[model samples]
Target: MAGAPEASPGESRLRRVPPAEVEAARMEAVRRYDILDTPPDGAFDRVAAMAARLFDVPVASVTIVDADRIWFKAIHGLEGVAQIGRDPGLCGSAILRDDALVIPDTRTDPTARTNPLVTGPLGVRFYAAAPIITADGHRLGTVNILDTKPRLITEADTENLADLAAVVLDAMELRLSGLRLLREEQERRKAEEEARTRAERDTEAITAFATTLQRTLLPPALPPVPGLELACHYQTDSPRDVGGDFYDVFSLGGQRWAFFLGDVCGKGAEAAAVTSLTRYTLRAAAQHHDDPTEVLDALNSALLLDPSMGSRYCTCVFGTLRPAPGGGFSVTVAMGGHPPAFHIQHGDDGAMVVNGVRPRGGMLVGALENAQFASRTFHLAPGHGLLLYTDGLTEARLPDGTMLGEEGVAAFLTTRTTPDAGRLIEDTIALITDLPTGPGDDVALLALSVPLAPATEQTAALSTARTLATPVAGAARADQER
Candidate 1:
């Protein structure tokens, strides 16, 4: 089987092994590090250059053994990219042996004599390769050195190359570790930002839901009393959660009814509580007085009793309505420095307006220990109307720092006097909306019109109509009631 150990001494040095087993070992070594087709790393390049200088070789490389190729992570003195098939790379074959293989003269050896790197491109006549083995005894690849001119390599040179080969393997491990740490840091930052965004969106959604619930707390519909047709508009200017503008209607004794519209000075649940308390107190107090002045005085006392009323107060208008023999009504209105009422009358010309004779007398509710009340009596005949409103509608702000104004309210009514109370409100609201900007406070409107009757209705309808309507169409004084 040994075949006479080759007749010449040069042939004896061939050291043949089974070709099939040798190729299998080369493939096994390449797969151990699991690095293939990866980019060049700085750590490996450092060791490769060091190896060239330390060993005093013409070339050095960190060579990786592939199934059919030897890929270079780094190279010195090689032409361009250092990747070639397994059979051409002398380092790939040298890996099969345990010790370093020094082919002092490749031209004298039959195995490497015809190698293209030695006979062609690299023109190599001398080659020495030391396997880069990990601590676990896995042969990852090789640290190889080559020369174009044949020369003798002493034992000192070979051992130095072997020690440097170990250093290259250690550097490759450190580079792999750093890449993993950077990936983990990126993932942590992404998760924190996503959590913050979710919390902000949830807060906004809950606030809007609370506002819709607050609007439901108001009276959904107003009752139409005979001899008088009443319409009211109560709306919060901002939906940032509804503020405290509220109104109520409940029956009192002797065919009379009690009604009031009021606004607390703040927003949120605290102000809403004040609005609720004022509404019920006015209804309860109406039992004692068909008079508007007495009802407001009782409410003022009730608010003073609440412990939180120290710095808080409300502005309100309380009214009482009684039916007359004819199709008309009389209203006694008392105000606590709230806005004045608007009244409209119909004539041959068209529907006309009258400003309130006087807004009633009182101070901010609950601010004083004993607040005085004054009353004004007015009559509403059939085919006439009265409008009582909160300041929100008149005080809506424009971007120019000018209020939407009492003048704007008058202009709105003169242009559109529709029969439907709800439609009149929507139209007036559109005027506020058309403005480029508006106020921080809420808006409310209450319009009461006398219903027209069948022809047998009244002979005095024309003359009585003039006394019924309040002329809000006139310019209101700046300090009148708003």
Candidate 2:
């Protein structure tokens, strides 16, 4: 093999060893590969083995040149040795050259004759190495072949050695890229899992707060009233949100008690705030004013005074129940743009009659500066009941686009055979729940009834009073303009 051309003394002055700064940069680039001192890889082993067979050399190695040492990444025909000193080897000098370094008969070559690797026990006579250059022009290592005996080599052999060096560099780059991608994928999955865990914890906290707040907005239990049986039920369309509909049966002291059911315009925290204010205001006003109409007027004024209640309004039925002389109760109900109250009466002949008691001219409360409400007085005898509810029941839509309107609800009540307050509420709930397309809005029901006793002489008079005091359906409209 013919050795690489040597530089003359004058040319050698221009070809000094790389400066300290340049060598530091080259070493840094080598470290970036992270392949130094690593275990043997099959890909590199194959390349070294191929170079030895192709060139018919006794030894072939894929060597990385560090600052002071030459490390063998892959070696063939070399046993139990992984590295050698850079001062005694050809690979270090090969990395400094831009082209392949070839030397035949090291005993005669001036550069090779001084190398310990050539003059020592394992006498190396012929040597060929290709520099492994990085993309940025840093030569970090070499793929070299050596023979103990001098031999002749063709130009094609030198070219083939350079090609094998390229293969080794490509394998290193491919491995580093795959490792980077895998690390990135693992980091992405870890971030996603953390986000999901945070969301679950947040949802749980919100649900607990909503439930506790909803309980405060409604009555814990209906207040017990003398001679009157009361039952109520409330349901929401979604568990995630707090419903705006509210109902309460609270005592105003003595035999007299106040009850009201209403629905705010929207749902959620804002509506919930309004609901809390409404329930507190109604109870406070009812305690001072015994009249239901006056109580509603107080609410309208409070809502109007608070400008924060922007564009928010509610439909309500506020009522006061008091025991009437002779064995029954008299209820004065005031309506504020709410649905009609259902009255179920049992006749002397045992036939049940259902009537809707609605006071017209009632406008939405809290909507205008001067909204009017309607009030009506009715007598409830034994076996007679009154039902008040929010519009969620009547406005429930069926699959056919038809609503369970006032008529539909009245029909449902008529089919029941004289149910008490509790049974009446349960049956209505069953009807609302059984709809094929479930109720889209929240439902609230309040039922008040008098217990039935055996037929007595006072029964006839009580029955007559209830019939004569029955509130005419649009009676309030006459006073609406006032």
Candidate 3:
């Protein structure tokens, strides 16, 4: 709202002032970057140096236009000069345009011929600069090259200087993203600490704290995927104790996605910490390498090597889904000492068949430094779905005093009429709810399926109920084959 700082004794002041609102917005942009008078950064210094060398100029600088002065974040070929005033036709003028500003000879340009940089002791002649613009159209600064003697440059040279500006903007964005993540983590930790303090005094507070803490470990809802349906549910055995079961569904780029479900070895705060680490490591690793096996291997290393993750291990199944040419999704799953996921399909006779999709020889993650994970690829055709769950479901104690086991789960799937993902989750939840004694541990379920197309002759027949064990012929056969 106030006027720009007055010019020094010899420097000419800015002749025109931007609208108050525009100046206010511009200053806000500068504050968000937090780049004013900051410590030197090697990456920025390199950009300034490269610009000077590439343009064969003696002076180059990465400047951030501040309220009172033009701050040099990085400078080359300029000694003992950290910044200069907002001169009329230098960086302050360059930042006003959308493209690069080039004056082949500053002495011949009417607007800048009298500027101090041209008339002062430096006796600058050539000046070229590209405005460093933000994605939202805020011109934050400039990347400029200057010469003591007049010179000319090709259009390509101007473009290259612009590219250097872009590089600077990208580095800033990446740094900003990291800072945001660090701040969020700190806030979450602070909230957790306050919750724990209150939990010690009130019984009700303990339950609410555990519930809120657990929600943070898992996604609130599954993301919608085109041509596919998704549903997930998590049930913890106790409200006062934190469970380590976690699952996530996220995009891996266009038309492809990655999902994972895992459980850490123990319960309470230690297990909760490991659960958080494992879930984030999987998401980060998927960005670099989409291979299910490689992603799991990265999690394994992260767990085993992290000093904070002592004695924690996990069983996980990581998988990816992509659109299939035949109107379904192609799936590839990798396992690490985890229970098998069930593939539910309808036969030509319309009989429902359930098979275990297990890749043998996958080891427990974080249990060993040299762990080997296994992967299997399969087609999730239309009228089919896959169900992944934690061991809590199979280990549930029945009224008859026997565990449900994998065989019991396969048998239960046959009783369902459809492979719809949401229905599968609902039925599974109901199954656990009806038990006289509830599940003994936490249960996390993730189901994905493609919508069945218009009724064809193949699917129009009367449906039957059946079971086929492919990857796992039977529980015993599975172990024998492995």
Candidate 4:
């Protein structure tokens, strides 16, 4: 306590200390802010610097009054000191008042004359402070400005100091709020990342299970049919969900093979289950009956008996192929609300064309107990073949909003010469692949053709001409049929 003035015989105190309860509550409020003893902050330091410049004071500080000390949170102009005893500083008396305290000449005032800072070697003669009050009516500390020479402060000076103290309180509240918001935002981001990771893992597991089930529903490889060359392809719309399209070729006994292609109503696990039931049922039913129509009738009955089907149905094309008497094949086809098959014929001139053959008036099977199905018979001679496909082909949309309907398919077929089943299928797949948009449904294609003669026997004919000539009689027959 330097520069303290000697006490006179009769002198009154400048300010009264708060009651014990009030002082205890005031101290609790200061501790609740959690700001004391912390490191220097730029925000509070800036306020102290601005206060010094505005008042033209040699020293300015933001100080908090504790039980036994006045501690500086921010200081300007003073060096080598951070705190002092409660009894020696002007800020201690300022904390007991609700308004600013101004001592123009501390040495002349009886209450401040005995203060050590004024009478000691430090020589602080003028001091002004505004109380930093809490929201609950407790004064915690002050924003103080001090000078060595005595000087008077105007009313405007007192108001400016009050405003500066308000700025200090605002900075403290904002800092606390900002820290709380930052912690909440970090927690939200962590939760979202964990949810995303879990979803990805679930999708991978479902896709693997669907792929394994799909493989079991189809034939491993087409059983080689004597006197016929076969090629089939299937395409799925998405790898994440199983599609409803299915096709199989299996043997019934000697010289007879059963083949079927179908599409169920929806997608995913339910449609996959239906597809499996249809495929196995057809294989077993064909053995009990020789007629294609009777086999489809049995399928209709089985679907109607099952309650789990739940108003769902499917469209199918079922057929049996057998060797003809002479040198070709005869196919009996039954239809159940399915697309027609294309019979591709080669002209004598080697130009290839397509002819669609459909069974008349077939009903949607599995939807009704007494649904009707129809059958048709066709002969595949040498240099002839047949192609069966799902509606996903003809229903595909081009960029120009035009559909590749039945006529479009016929035009596609007429572009090729010599009906080779594998080549025809490859060209059809390329057409769909080249479109700007993908087909929204599943596509399945099955082509069966009669093989050409051995290369040795046709070597002389091949040498004579690379292109086959169109005969007058065969051309006339094709025109009459058209």
Candidate 5:
């Protein structure tokens, strides 16, 4: 016994140190529950109370073992106490074994004699515990029972303690599964919110691009003309897509004005590109040519020359306006595979007359090598108006599923009592919007009228308008004969 080391007061001789890797894994299992130092629950408290009653012991605890301490999750009959140092004779030693640890007399047992629970104030003399083992073969801690006096217990009593340990493990597993489900739900909601934000941003970007491109394809505002009234309207089926319908009114010098309205073949960017070229080409051609027919011929030639036009063609009506020596406008119109322009005038009985001016034999622009066009010269007498439109209006479906064709337009125009350009555009827009199915394609409208003079001057203007109708009226009557 010489040079022997004395045992410390809180130490034990029964401790068996596990391999470093084994201990590390056990520690990790303890951390996985995250049960250390948490608030007490009534569930674990009830289990501990049952253990104490079944074994007739004064104290019972459900514990979790840490590296340096053993924490009590629930303790029955042990007040004002929560944890203690990791002594190998108690809960720490029980967790190392697969079965229950039983010491009937702690004071007489060499392994437990120096443990703090035996030497301290409470003087615990009997102790029994079973390790709470996970399915993966790692032990987290124990369910322990202690008494102040030494006593013997049967094998059946040891089995009861182990059953209580299994109860504690079940509670931990249920709590862990609930936490995992909550974490998964939070991640799902976060992903959906991110995808929704990205879709909104893409929609806004497309709208902005369509608006800017549409502006470049049409005139900002119609130019003002002396002794004449002009009005226009445009409508598109979708805000997100660029339409191919276009119109413009510009001066061609020397008291003459040029105007055109057309519809390209498709929708979206390609259609918009062709619309821009068509508008500018017509405007540039009008400046060089006095006749409306020559202006349209020039546009047809330009569309054929540009390779970028790419198999696209259009239907258009081009016209020139000059002051008549009588009292109205002398008008010349050229057509290229387009709808008839409506001529609204007053009859001999002062009733309204709506006539469609269809010059014969015009071919589609940009469709062939030598596409022919047709032209007509007419007298736009006072109290008369001309309406040019794309086919989107006539092609619109009615409530009866029938198309509102050229005849329907003529019938609508017949209801008007006076020639007013601005009122004509406003009423036309309202009609289109109130359609049963609305316009299926893009719609463009352009109207021109020479204002009527006062009652006394109107009489003189009428006689003058009739005299100017003589030579040009021959051309107008020829169109009617067709």
Candidate 6:
């Protein structure tokens, strides 16, 4: 710290205020900002860096005045006194100037050279001080530059001081914005954690009941289709983390069993709202249009009525598993923003699964007024098993936060294929279950297998199954009628 040149006898270049008045005004302005005695931050440190470079001074600082001391939020080439005695600070001198105060030579000036700062511990000789003003024009303090040797600061250095002060204000504003977002995120997490804790402590009572209700919302049991052995297994990452992940199997008026697996975008109640709406609507619309594409189209049309629902969308695979009139099963599936289904066929040694058709999701739900989906047809060979899963299974993160990607799913089916759904569900959650705090999403999978029947039972099964089929009375909403 050093004293600045005093006004000459005849003409004063720097704006001057009474020492007492300046000190009092400084205290009020600094307190108004409420940035006193705070921790160091990137925003404040950056001002010191810029000042050092722009002024070519060894020491640059943003100093604030409290009751009797000057505190430095940012300091360069200066240490020990985050706070200093208020008596003879170069910065205190700067606060008196509405503009900057530049002193080229301190030794020749009687007022500056005689001051203790010039001859005492600091040994400062050259100095520049620029007032730090609030938006309302109150000078809080100063951002000053200092050097040990006597030298002049250029006109450019003087001009940049005001500009650098403005930058300090902008930096402060940015820091406030970051703080606001951090608070919002923290509050949201706290609310969620409290709800989760409450739910976990009472699992068997309310938790079990909620799980039962969620289960009942699915089809009561897999539809008794003619030749298809269908069973679905769904397990969430955590019990209380219940979400809108569903697998359903229902009849489509004839030999067809319409099955689907879908997951709503978010977790908790909002997701469940959209999920419930989609499930019932798809079921109800099946009466009119049993095609997978048609059901999704109807769901899309329903969701678009909500404008704030850009956050709402579902990834679903909707398809029909029918005992073909002549042979195995004829499957026609359409996807809507969902992952593709994998089919495992019988090989000589064991069963092998491959993605015969790519992961396809037609139009993103709620994207526009009208979005379309196209359906694809394929044949399921004898003893083939079909698996449809949500991204929760594929993107499941491990303890290290790595995702269980397609490669991991591929390895699971290489040597282990059985009564499909149960094994699949067990393996999927094996890595995910232990994560109490994690990237938890819902897992919904449907497994449909058609085992080869003995010669005697084969002939009678298809005919008897057709006899069990209920006829469609109406076209519209007919698919949902069942």
- Count clashing residue pairs per candidate: 9, 0, 0, 6, 0, 10
Model 6, range 1-482, lDDT digits (tens) per residue?
Answer: 43444666644545565667665665676665567888875445656765786567788888776666678888977777678776666666666667787777667766578767678777778777777777766677677777888897667667677766765654454344335535655665666677986444444443443454455445545545556555454555555444777777777776766777888887654565566667766775665676778888877766664455566887777887776655568998888877777777656766665554553448765565677787898887556667777787778766677786777666766656553433544444444455544334566656666555522332211111000012112111100111
Write down the lDDT of every candidate, Cα atoms only. 0.62, 0.74, 0.76, 0.71, 0.74, 0.63
Q: Report the candidate with higher lDDT, 5 versus 6.
A: 5
Instruction: Assess candidate 4 and give its TM-score to the true structure.
Output: 0.53
In candidate 1, residue 303 scores what lDDT?
Answer: 70
Estimate TM-scores for all models.
0.50, 0.53, 0.55, 0.53, 0.53, 0.49
lDDT string for model 1 (1-482, tens) is: 00011223444323344377655664565554456777876446655665676567778888876666778888876758767776545765555556676778878977677777766766888788787776655556788787888878888677766765765665555334334434544654565477977555554544454454454446655653544444555456555454777776557767787777778888765576566556656775687566788888877776774344555688888888777666666877888867766556654677555555346456677778688877788776676666666677788776787886777676666666543333454565566667776444666656555566623232211100000011122111111000
Q: Give the top-scoring candidate (lDDT).
A: 3
Candidate 4 C-alpha lDDT tens digits along 226-335 = 66666666666665566788887778887888989888888865676567657756876797789999989866765554455676688899999887776567889999
Please provide, for model 5 over 1-482, each residue's C-alpha lDDT reduced to its tens digit, 9 standing for 90 to 100: 00111233444533367799998999999999888999986447756876887688999999998888889999998898887777544787777677888889988887677777888888989888889999998999899899999999998788768867876786676456435544644664665578987666656655555565566567766665666667776667676677888888788888888889889998875576567557766876676678877877866765664444567888899998888876778898899999999999888988889888879987888787688889998998777889999988999888999999989888888887776776676667667768888877777778877677622221211100011012112100000000
Candidate that scores best on TM-score: 3
lDDT of 2 by residue, 16-116 (tens): 47788889999998999889899987657767876887788889999998878889999999899887777645776687777787777888887778676
Model 1, C-alpha of 63: deviation from truth (Å): 90
What candidate 6 gets wrong by more than 4 Å, as runs, is 1-206, 348-351, 359-361, 398-400, 417-439, 454-482
lDDT score, candidate 1, position 294: 81
Which regions of candidate 2 are displaced past 4 Å? 1-198, 454-482
For model 2, give the 10-residue run with minimal summed lDDT: 473-482
